[model samples]
Target: METQIAGSIARMDGSTSQDAIFKDVLAYKEVLAHIMKTCVPEYKDCTIPQIIGYIEPNPQVGQVGLHPDETNPPKIQGMSTESTTTTEERVVYDVRFSAVAPGEDGKIGLIINIEAQSKYHPGYPLVKRAIYYCGRMLSAQYGSVFTQSHYGEIQKVYSIWICTRPPKERENTITSYTLQERHLVGHVTEPVRNYDLMNVTMICLGKPEGKHYGGLLRMLEVLFTGRYAAKEVIQILEDEYEFAHAHTMERTVSEMCNLSQGIFEEGMEKGMEKGIAQGIERGMEKGIAQGIEKGIAQGIERGMEKGIAQGIERGTNRERLQNIRSLMETTGWPAEQVMTAMKIPAADQPKYLKLLSLPQ
Candidate 1:
């Protein structure tokens, strides 16, 4: 029990599933029975047997509340009244153990509560256990508060706990605490019934000084050794692993292949979208260039018609305008150059040409 409980798969809030808990419980039933039997010696009476019942619906293992004191208190020198109110509050468990025993009142007593622990709340487990035992004994006697008198019956309780770790740095593996009364001034001070406490036996499982914890030590060894020694207990504990290393590798490869395929498909989809966008932009640019060229051609044609009309008006109205076709023949210019130099009105070009020694 000196080693700490180690595991790669640690328990978290959401890690536990119903199936996991059920499977684990079934597999570790033997260990659970052993722990319970060792804790509660009364079960060895050959009457009551250890059982794994369903999880409690309403568990009050860590509950604490303020309650009124049922007894009187001590008086101070200047105090007027000799009474003071106090609180007595604790948690109660819901499970029970059935057994018959002789009570202090020389009557047959039936102990009800078996065992309970507050695993989460720091140091409240032992306190909660005591309160639960008390409550169970009280309930068995009166049946219910409405049916019988308060504190009538005499029942017994046995509370036990199994822990993986120790409480703080305490040395003793098992420690018990109980209520006690001390004499004060002159007359015995009114009994501080609220402080009428009980004992607690804390068994720190982490101590391995002796062989008294054979079962706990074995459990711890299995957890810490690292080497997988296939004992019956280890096999039961390993019921959680569903596959061997080879099968695990195969499953991992399969999942990776699926993920790779999905990534490839997604990348292709994004590429297609980008390509479509670029294609549309290129088509629009090409269409705009073609339109601009066509507009420029039409504008050039309109300008040519306007220039011809103006040239005809100038030749007919202005006397200074000369038919330069005779100057073009005298100069012997090339066809293109002649056309440029002989600036004649197109409407009067035929009459002007008849006047010159030009061919028909």
Candidate 2:
């Protein structure tokens, strides 16, 4: 009797925007219930239909105006095409079910609101759950009041929080906050309603005993823990849940597997692009060094050729000049220093300095 439930799974980064996760989660409403029942045994008495009843249409809570028809009570319109009301997404599901316990007056009952949560948010989700429950109950009974209680006195508001992350010893402890009596100074007792607190109950599904949760645990073990789970957990995957049996669980398993593969491929493509960029940088460095060396070699070769050509011409024309230089050398400068100071044709000096500067 299970069918597709609406709502997506959050992305790997836990982004709820990815409709992919929601679509798959919606596809297996039965699985969702199984997990819930396992984690909270109180759910065994709670039917899926009841859970759906506790659930409001909108996943988010805020002021929303329902269509004229939605505002009307549930009734079969006898299949009339002229029924002017239309359904829209603006109507959010604020709850799954409203559990009522009879109050002392019996005229009004205590409302225990049950809200299912899977994604992580920074604020106290349970507080939202409490406020929404109170708001919905107030609105259902009293449209608006500047400042007064209506629909009889609120007996108690219970907010149940189901979370995906396990409670941490340092921070994630199971906690409940409520208005209680405490001594003002001595033995005199005073009630604390700091901002009208309600009974808030938080259950962190990420606990180690989380795996011990029947349906929810089985689902999470396969989805999160993977290969590291114990033998009993592995057996649960092999037996009760279809996500474990890759062959039998086609739709759910296939969808999750494909999504994971796509995410992996996307990461690899980005990495490859980075690697290619590094390779190109290295290649450019090598090319620049080679170009510089080739230019220097070409310049030296041209200079040496010009110098040899000039020396040959000077040798033929130098008898008078050469004898004059020999007579002037009587200045007694060391022969090596005199030779160094001699103005050689600019062409011959170029190749000599070029050869000397090259590393041996």
Candidate 3:
């Protein structure tokens, strides 16, 4: 039953099962608290419990924003994980919620959106997407957060992207882009709170062995990487990170690992089957072209062997080249950096570099 369920989950659309599991784990108050303290400037100095208290429970996961109508004005249209535009365009969020700022005033709150990004170079600039998300979040607040030009009531917005597989140079790093006040002439400054409403934070994660793999980086790596067993992950979270939700963590982590294994196994099986099919086809083709019984047999035997080997090799190399190109184009990484990060063989580096030099 477990295997069957895993298989079913593995077939979900575009890693949906894995993404859902990640959302389940991250939605935990304890986990959110850790992220808040480590990533959010407002909660940087707050205690874990304090941060947890500030976080509203049952954050909307995969929420969608509906277009406001006559009955439901924009002011009443609450925040959600996704929003539908007039043109039927959709913007979906992984996790979206509001958290009160840790202060005696208790008036300021943050509208936060958390995204679990599996790809680092997803065709376009991720930072720009993050900024766009921030913009959407801010604009979404027009009537819900504050109405009728009451801009002061506008809560700060944060779009935090946790990139699981980034380039080596960006591994285990957290960078934030926010509204910074730059003065060109006289040094007069407005209050930071007034203009610091939008923030985009990118947290790129690598393996746990890196020097910077400590604190939030290590914690997230352990939770999402599936490198360790569920029990071990839970133990680490509890002992090292002081996470108290042992049972929930264990269950979610275990589910994620099982689903990931299922997906991996399914992929491998498909790859092998495809390679074998190509080998058989090529073997038959060569045998027919020979037009001799003995020659046909020999041709098929050789073709089968060569085709199997070359099919898999070609597929792998093609994928590697695509990844390298994507990294270079999106991250602007030099060919050397991309090759090193991808661990391309020294002998093959020149070939790949040459291939990269050609115009796409």
lDDT of 2 by residue, 1-360 (tens): 111211123445644332444234332334444444443333556665443333233233333226442242121111111111145222233233323322234422333433445444656554665555555443433332223644334434445554444434312334455656755677954333222335565555453453335454435534432223234433455576533222323434444445544554776799899889988998898889898999999889988999998898667435433433464467666433433567555555444445334563
How many Å off is the CA of 95 in candidate 3? 0.1
Order by lDDT, highest first? 3, 2, 1
- lDDT of each residue in 1-360, candidate 1, tens digit only: 111111211235844332222222222223333333444333333211222221111223333223221011010011011112244433333233333432234533333232322132464555565555554344434543225454433333444443333444542254444456665756565433234322233444444454454453444323322223234334433343211211212222223233334444676799899999988899889899988998899889988898899898666534322335445567876434544555545565555445444543
Task: Estimate candidate 1's alpha-carbon lDDT, on a 0 to 1 scale.
Answer: 0.38
Point out where model 3 deviates above 4 Å.
Answer: 1-16, 57-79, 103-106, 261-360
**1-360, model 3: which lDDT tens digit per residue?**
122123223225564567777776666677777887978989878898777767753334443235332222111112477876687457898888887885446647888888999888999999998888888888788778789979888889888889887899999899999889999998998988889899888989888778788999998887776677888887888899887655545555688777656655776899999999999999998877766877878899999999999999888878888999889999898989989988888899998877767887
lDDT of each: 0.38, 0.43, 0.77
Worst 10 residues of 3 by lDDT: 69-78
| 1 against 3, candidate with superior TM-score | 3
Give candidate 2 regions above 4 Å deviation: 1-94, 102-141, 144-155, 165-173, 185-197, 207-360
Best by TM-score: 3
- Candidate 2 vs candidate 3: which has greater TM-score? 3
Q: Residue 89 in candidate 1 has what lDDT?
A: 38
- Alpha carbon lDDT at 279, candidate 3: 94
Instruction: Compute the lDDT of residue 286 as modeled in candidate 3.
Output: 86
